[model samples]
Target: MDEFEKSSIEGRVIELADSSRREVEQEANEAKAEQQRYIAELLKNSSKTPIVVSAVLTSDHQSIRPDVLQKYLDATILQASSFSQLCEQADLLNVKLIQHGMAENVSQSLDSRGILRLPVIKRHYPSLVYESQAISGELAVIDVISRLNILPIKRFTAKTGTNIGNGEGDGYLQFQLRNMFGGGEQLKLDITKGTKTHSSYLLDYGQPVTPWWMLNSMLFKNSRQFGNNNSIDMLIRGFRTSLRSGFQEAGAINHELFYEAEWRTSKLLSLHASDTLLFQAGDDIKSSLGHTLAVDRRNNPIAPTSGSFLKITNELALGKYWKSQVEFSQNNSWLKDDFIGSCCTFRSGYIANLNSSKKTVNTYDKFHNGGANDIRSFQIMGLGPKDLYDSIGGDAFISYGVSLFSRLPIKKWSHSNFRLHWFFNGGKLINHNNAPLKSVVTQLANQHSTSVGFGILLRHQVARFELNFTLPLTVHSGDAMRKGFQYGIGVSFL
Candidate 1:
């Protein structure tokens, strides 16, 4: 406790205190190092590259094999840029598979007491515009799984707005099963049920004339090609329609069955064949309406409604220069009805690609109903005389025509096309007695006319929709046959 003793004690105490502080600092440093190591390990594990997997489950939900999942992961890696990308892509593929009816989860049984879960991962990238604007660089990654509940099967019936006054309704029921097969072509089936009614009245004197009930069946399949260019297609259809009139002795029924098959080769040549059979049964109009009404003179009285048709078309590409198509169609309706009608058409066209312009020329030869149904060029009017020639006993004859078209691009999304067409179309109508050539010529002079004209087309196809305007340069009699200028809307698939 003396002065010397007090200094010695203070020195000893200071040394002790410094030594304790050093020890504590060393321990703190060691602890900090250990904490850093732990954090480094955690980061390493998180960055160890995620193991991705994908599976296409069967209808009877079963877990996919590990090897199958690995294969899918490998395939995905080949297309992905990073681990995060791979996870996101897997989720997207799974969603797509489910949407396409390719997979299902069966964690929940049909008892409706359990929940089924599916995993989904989402990633965000810097938006292009935002990045260019130097905005916040923050990005996000979200991972979650959704649970879907299973419910019992139930049936329901409902009436649609399209249902006429008939109180008819539609019913539907669906159920799911597991253990279905995978890894095959996608299948799609469509079933439609509906009814159509057609009624017509005379324009001159409005009156309820005929009410028809039609039962139509239409089936379509997704277009599939075997090779890069070859394709095979098939279709089957049927229709039954009935015409009823209270004043008539009895109603009439018409039935139609059609089948079509097409085979296209790799060389871009397509061959199509179709067969159609029609059957009709009804009261003879001649005895019912023709004798009673003077306005029914142009109507078919006691006409045969049953008929058949066979059509074949061969489309061939003429090298890089042109394309040629030929079609032959025969109708047995006239034969069954004691009249004869048939048609043969030959179409040839050439496409010219110039430095600043393109050109096309098409020619056709048609027999039957003049060039009405066979012509590919624009038609000035839908109205045509019933007869123009006496060569054939019925209203049928042969005609040929040609059309030339050229296009030039005036600006982006805008183009101008010009078409020049000439047609020689004429046909004949049959009467009770054979008509002489002179008389037929006189009738044709009064009822028929022919001409050639040119048309200009303007079109643009830049936006989601396409617009076009067609104007005739030389307005011939047939071109102006209708009263108003022709203006149309909507895009053309052609």
Candidate 2:
């Protein structure tokens, strides 16, 4: 061969006249596109097709009895427009079913030795398919996952705290059982001990009456020591039942209707207790029906920067007595973010003993005023009438407070849970024994004690603490005063 003809070709090319690589690739892509379009059409048509969800058949479960599961299934109405919709409904039903099963007291996966004998879910859901449609257009199959092994439906918690400034400590232990009988019922027991509250024991039981309502019953016994202001000890044991509306969100209005029966005893803690306090000491029984309505919208309850709160309560006791109380507070932020804020609060209460034979109301049922929680410069229950050295409480009272709050100036501490607080408080407490209601109200408005203070405030999870320098601006003869620095710690404050 000639040199030109013999020159080696580095690459070889094979070409078919009927087909090329580009054409082949384009054909393959077109086939894939057609297949996808067909699939899309099928899915669209299937989604619009009618389907019937005639029944929901849950798998066998050992923890929840068959009859109980059946009742839950029967209560639910099943309807669906398409297979996908049917699946959605089945999912919701499955969730409820699992919850009901888990609430049962029986253990499904545990054996005698406490070892897992089977898969938790498999034990609860014996069959993978929860519901199967029959004799209809396209049948839908839904699988529900159920957990047979669950944590015990009970819990125990302990809370402890101390106020080193006051040399006081408190602790609480609570035990709760959830769904005790598999009907969404709960039982709780609380035991408390502290320096101020000598001791307390309570048993509470509650159950959901509706999605937005609950029924609760409680038995409680408490012993509390009133310090210098009263120098008395009080014991109250009571049984109360109430129906409460769920106020799960801010700004929601809530109502509570309750009936309470209490046995109360007042005893002197000091040998020099006042004659009025001694006269009020003894056993008393009260039966009352009451209602409480509240609307709260605070952004943060611990240290509110915005919104308002209002609560009104009324009680009727012994077919002869009437008591009413109202409380309100409004808070607003004056500067951007949480740098500064202001709050206004008002509280008033009245008790009337309408018995034609009796002139005095129960001491424990009367209103007591003056405290770090209320008027900062006064001792607890100190602003009311006093017999010798003890505050005898009052039949009618009115209190109001105005407060300004700001964050620390340092950049590093500006966002901390510490606040500078300035406040003005004023109130009056009237005994008004056998006095007309109108006269008592007039006295409550005309005679009062006033105080002003500034303090450092610390907001804690369980309580708010304050170190304040308080000055009594105005005071009556019997109103106890605490000038200069005062320390306070409590869950509620004005």
Candidate 3:
């Protein structure tokens, strides 16, 4: 059996029968009638015989040709052969080294229910063709894959952005649509204009677990001086539509179920003084029904390095307000393949103002914390319960943060995603005038507060920029005291 050991055992028997096929998903006339009954039973008893062909490249590389491939083979062209009975008659015609790209277009799967349009994915798989050619290999290609699964790529889109903060200036516009009538349903539109110089809105509620948009664009040049009320002007409009399905997926974490309908309208490019006492009393309309149950086994969402990300979001709005959110984060490696590690984040949530527990809980959905990303040195929501310096958000809340990342021992910033850590952040946001979670976990240990710091986490490209200089070292004097430097911000590390 020499001819390179019969072409390496007929290319390892068409790679163990395409890795034991069956990832179930076929229909473009059942994958063109199973590639025409497996090439008509491999040319039913030697139809014009001479078989000895080979090709490769599809372990993510994808591509195969071997010259027009005898238009789908009935057999002829011959060259060299130690033919081990043509690899046992191409393994009883179950051969499938699939990978054809409609002239470099792109796609080999991702049709899902729209009915197989499979085409793209082919770059380099055309070598070893000893005896191959003679054609009649009959290929209808499922009526050209059923006219490429009804090819219509619907459309709509608009987007705009201009933002500058600190002194204040913001602008935004957006619109989107996707496969609307073809089952993939999606639509979105948004408009916004903004300016604010913090006249109490809990300094715009700080980090309840990261994402304050660069301290809201890192304070856009700090611009606070407009007029009546003192500088906070804004307008917003939104619309949402979404559809995604596929859950369980036979294991190894990849679940999804997102269905949403939202309409929001918030206006106040006028009134201020933190909207007097809730909207100063004007326009408000919110209608919502949302659900998100996401569990992703993250390897690197920007710079995670390891895995674990959990999300549980629930929003229900019929009359005025309802909120539910729980996010979990995890990361590892204290030198497993040595990339420096340790990370755990837990974000809790709550928002209840179903009209009267005396009416509140909507500063566009209140949840606040100290700045730079959940209590780094306090100031945004400035650590709860206060009415003079503002931050009056509470209806039941809890936040927690844990960090221990390292590897800036300086080796030219030791392989990026930059780090250096030591952190502990505990939280409690309350105003549950009807306490009881064991008296809110015993007034959450004196309305809980914790801080221990040493920071520097630059890593951008999806966010995480911090510069903390904390020191609240267990205090009790009326709480809200953020001694020195604090400008933290984090994102999606969940």
Q: Name the top lDDT candidate.
A: 2
> Residue 383's C-alpha lDDT in candidate 3?
67
Per-model TM values vs. the true structure: 0.22, 0.67, 0.26
Superposed Cα deviation of residue 400, candidate 3 (Å): 7.3
lDDT of 2 by residue, 341-458 (tens): 8999999988877883754676567888877888889977778877777666787889999999999999899989899999999998887766887787678778679999999999
Report the C-alpha displacement of residue 113, candidate 2, in angstroms: 45
Range of the 10 consecutive residues with the lowest summed lDDT in candidate 3: 208-217
lDDT of every predicted structure (CA atoms) = 0.28, 0.72, 0.49
Each candidate structure's count of clashing pairs: 8, 0, 17
lDDT of 3 by residue, 1-494 (tens): 59999999999998877765633434456888989999777646434332223321222221223333223222311121213333333331112111111121212211112222222232111232346575322321111110111123334657788655223456766665543342223345444456553221111111101110111100111223222333333333333333333222122343233323333333344434443333433445566676667776766566676787887777777765677878788888766345567778888776655775555655445666655566555555666665433455665667777777777776786877767777777777777654445775566556477777777777787677766667766644345667666655556421
* Residue 474, candidate 2: C-alpha displacement in angstroms: 0.9
Model 2 RMSD to the real structure? Answer: 15.5
Once fitted onto the true fold, the runs of candidate 3 whose alpha carbons sit more than 4 angstroms away are 1-131, 134-290, 299-305, 308-312, 324-334, 337-339, 344-358, 361-383, 386-402, 405-422, 426-450, 453-494
For model 1, how does the per-residue alpha-carbon lDDT over 1-494 read when each residue is reduced to its tens digit?
Answer: 59999999999999999999999999999999999999778646544232222222223323333443334335443244334444455554454334323345212111122332222223223222443665543332222222222121111222323322112222222222221233211222233332211111111101111111112222232222211112222121222122222221122222222222222111112332111100111111110111001111112222211222222222222321222222222222243222222222232221221211331111111122211222222232222322121111122222233323333224432232221122222222222122454554454444333323333333233211212222322222322222212222222111
**Clash pairs detected, candidate 1:** 59-178, 59-179, 59-180, 60-178, 60-179, 334-339, 388-427, 389-427
The TM-score ranking, best first, is 2, 3, 1
